[model samples]
Target: MSASAGVVVLGNTYDFFSRTRPRTVRRLAGRGQAKRARETAEKLLRDIIHAYDSVPSLTFRLLVVEDVATGGGGWTFTAENEYKVSCTLYAAAYYSTQVCVDDVLDQILNVGDRPGSLVPFNHTTTSLRGVVEAGQWVAAGQTLSWDTSQRGVEEPRPCIKRLSDPPIYRCVHEPEGVTVAAIRQETGTVLQITLNPLEYCRIGKGGAVFTK
Candidate 1:
């Protein structure tokens, strides 16, 4: 499946210019104007969120400040403070539609059949039911799931990973379905769930259901 990425920017454009440009009397006068533009952008972001939040499935993350840069272009007299205010607050929204498409691609690639079903594993009351270690051999079930309720993938404690912790699958019960999906959590918990047929389903725990 095709992967997607997003970026969000938030800050004062005028302030940025004022701080970076060759300071002088004329640039000082434009400070107030730059502030207003920054405020306007902030308000616009809020309004956009308000408008879309009414929709049932709409969700977003403000990943501002991940990377900041400054640049300017215009007629000669453009001072740093006078440079056009360009502070931007960015956010990304992924809908159910895109998720469905990803599922299709995973199926075609036979990702489910990969080693270790790659489900969620962790130690949280809400996630793993307070157990330090939990395992199951269900023909299906989610070993783990993530709490992406927070914004940005830049957190030190990421919800997803290429590595596994407490690394072992101790099955308490047979997998419920033919396919399974493992989701990692921010709190170090792994959520493993069995997937429906036609999805990226894993059958490593051994059962001759059908061909991949």
Candidate 2:
């Protein structure tokens, strides 16, 4: 499927889950029981994923269900509960396929549900240069650049910012002086690197590093 079309499906999936979450939670909390809340949440998410997959044109897979805990809270809910859900969407490209729980939470209170309000996550394509020297190294200190002009393209640079966080860093087109973190030779001419928001640095040399 085309990337744009795939994104539309994803947004629709998120909206569907958001609108149904309240009902699912209520069913799980039948008679105000909290003891099985976590398990119930997990089952509900699995059921939702199955229901979504029945669309014939879409695929939904559960990745994780975490932080499912119950507690006493303010007026609205005497027994407050919190949980996080993560799922993977088989979209157009590998880079566009990862879906986190926060993406769904962002839509939880979206009253308008306007199409314009459903913004896809930020992503970019990156091009790396340099020769892989002895031992599959790309020469220490080599830099990489983000091709912001090619946003939404396949094989995008794996850079992401948390939706709720203050803008601490933003990837730019053609960022300069960005150092290499590490590199693994995927093929004779292609290389791959691991990216983790928490490990943006401290990863060693000859690797790709996304610049802010």
Candidate 3:
């Protein structure tokens, strides 16, 4: 990743719970339910932002926040060109009944740094940490190495690769996909799998159309 690499971040929240209750139960329900719910939602937003900052790949950018009020439902997240990822929190609480529940949905845009390259499916099982590094290829379905338990017991595991699903961003001229193919030794780079000439042309042109 380049030092100047950047990724967009977004966040939003909504609440649907009410505070009105029967006169007899008003004492139990009307005190702090809404306040708690809102606080929880806001805290979740902050946590999402902090998480984005923790990742080394992204230099955080705080774009403008746009909100809309819905009729009993939460708002939808709209992705703009600048927004590469979004985290939304939806909270509902019954103030009159002291019922509170909140859910968080994180939609990561641009997928990740090495989106087009194949990666080890079960990295936790790979024991060659720091030794193997990325961009090296073991035979398909072959055991690259073993992972050890806390007690230092080794368990064998195989190296696997897969094509990453595209994310909500402009598709650049990245390698088409990755496989269990050979990695270039001099550069420690994984070889991208071959594709149809037409598709290859598309990627090579950097999103431009080629004349017939």
Candidate 4:
């Protein structure tokens, strides 16, 4: 099948098995196995589309690699009879007029666009989480300065004293549904991230911080 903008394309299961599986296995499996696999893949795609629909800012398209010569990185089959579909999720933020400061700070700190003075030691200290938690902002070209005298460190440190620790958004597979597959926001990297929609009918949940 072909994919368009905001469209979900379900690949043919028989084609998938015929190309990927050994000739002996295909001969033994017959048409019934292929039909069952196709149904499972389609159901998984439907669940994925439903979950993503809740997030109005995000749009996605399934990547169906029909040709083995083209490569096969996005597809996955699990023992639990699940088909983990690989897809590209696009954000609407690119067309928005307003800037997302949180995203900007995330890029600066975690994505390698940090300032020269920003030390590599736990860059989370200079992250937006610290700024928002402390109800303060560091001005342009200036980093947070901390007194390390009592702590016995030689250099000045940036810290949010009262805040316990920063929360990390690690890429992990859920028991059932969608999860971030990878993030590629380094110095000159292009694609920001990839998401794998696991083959299960479950709704994805997440939280966002908003400011007026």
Candidate 5:
């Protein structure tokens, strides 16, 4: 049983319940509903403990927040080439949505800093904190991508693609006044989204990707 360095700085509804609810978890005594809250908090703590178990010793913080007053109407997402060689990708997209506190625990497993883009929330709190040994802390809402020069790549050439999907999903999306780029298909059964050098695509794969 190893110890967890991740600390839960704020428990959900702690301040709210403190002000509105008369009794604390310890004072709940035989109050059934309050007992349930205690159980839920314990479960959340366990989940948070596991989240920071492998985040490497770096300057990082997971700030969890949820409020009803404001949220993003839409979002922009991007990614870039992590390698040295320049490559041409066929397609790209940007998708994103608001982050919710109910899914914070699961975010580390799937979304991480991607969904941390929401604006400042007064009621929000830092639920977990850690220190990484090597890398600096990345800012919230910024995907890791490098700005690279496309000087060493082959010149853009005329290429064509033909699809043979008979009974399947078909889609086409492009905005007016914007020139469309290359169109490609997924590699085998695995989906392969390509990004150009110093480019990235941000998609809202946050809370929606988890089991509700």
Candidate 6:
């Protein structure tokens, strides 16, 4: 196997810019599970966006992960969103829409090509949670808006239909009437659920059922 192919954490998850603990993410990235890193990063970003009002500091660091590939290295700072840079031959700069991201960790931060176009550094003023880790429990403090931001893809969504039983999930928008969806967990540890932003979802004790 290629031992050189691995993801390394370069920064901390709590401090906005602290170095990461080596094994904090080795469980996923080291095992060739890059998707986990991406998901975790996205969740963190969403959490920030959803709960930024109660959040405290913006000075938290990301789990700066460096994924080494055959061509070069892909550097990712896993936060609320996966922010990273790619290189085909060596260190280059390319990012994705992923939740939210910054630059190449070390780069020239500037605004438009003019002093008048210069945009001031933006940071949300509202404040609780800082950097949310994957699998961490986030309080459902606010009512989920039935807008585009609340929707999920055509995939199963986590829900809490029955607290006494294991977690139940469902999906919507296929062809016709309501149908059964898949469940991701064998236990009821999930406290949050996914909502399809495009359609209307009816959530009850039975589970989350949706429609177009």
What overall lDDT goes with each candidate model?
A: 0.26, 0.25, 0.22, 0.26, 0.23, 0.23
Once fitted onto the true fold, the runs of candidate 3 whose alpha carbons sit more than 4 angstroms away are: 1-32, 63-69, 72-212
TM-score of 4: 0.24
TM-score of 3: 0.21
How much is the lDDT of residue 142 in candidate 3?
A: 21
The 10-residue segment with the lowest total lDDT in model 6: 87-96
Across 36-66, the per-residue lDDT of candidate 2 in tens digits comes to 3333543543343233222222222112222
Q: Write the per-residue lDDT of candidate 4 for residues 1-212, one digit (tens) a residue.
A: 34552242333443354232333223322234333443464454344323322322323322221101111212334321222111111111011112243443343355233354322313555555544233223433222221122221021111223432211111212222322122111111111111232221211112111111
- Please provide, for model 6 over 1-212, each residue's C-alpha lDDT reduced to its tens digit, 9 standing for 90 to 100: 24333223332222334322233223222332343443453454344333322212111111111222111112343331322211111111111111222221111113211243211112221111332222121222221111122332122222223421201112212222221222112221112222222211122222222211
List the lowest-lDDT window of 10 residues for candidate 2.
87-96
Ten contiguous residues minimizing lDDT sum, candidate 4:
88-97
Per-residue alpha-carbon lDDT of model 1 for 1-212, expressed as tens digits? 22322211122443444343423222421345433544454454344323323323222222111111132333334343243222323322211112332232233124333344232222211232322222322222222122233421222222222332111101111112211112122122222222221211111112211111
Which lDDT tens digits does candidate 3 get at residues 1-212?
A: 44334221121223212211133122221224422433454454344333334323332222111111111112233322212112122211100101110100011112212334222222333333343223222332222221112211121122222321111111211122311222122222111211111111011112222111
Give candidate 6's whole-model lDDT.
Answer: 0.23
Q: How many residue pairs clash (N, CA or C atoms closer than 3 angstroms) in each of the candidate models, in the order given?
A: 38, 2, 0, 0, 15, 22
Which candidate would rank higher by TM-score, 1 or 2? Answer: 1
- Residue 24, model 3, lDDT: 15
Worst 10 residues of 5 by lDDT: 184-193
What TM-score do all the candidates reach, one by one? 0.26, 0.20, 0.21, 0.24, 0.18, 0.16
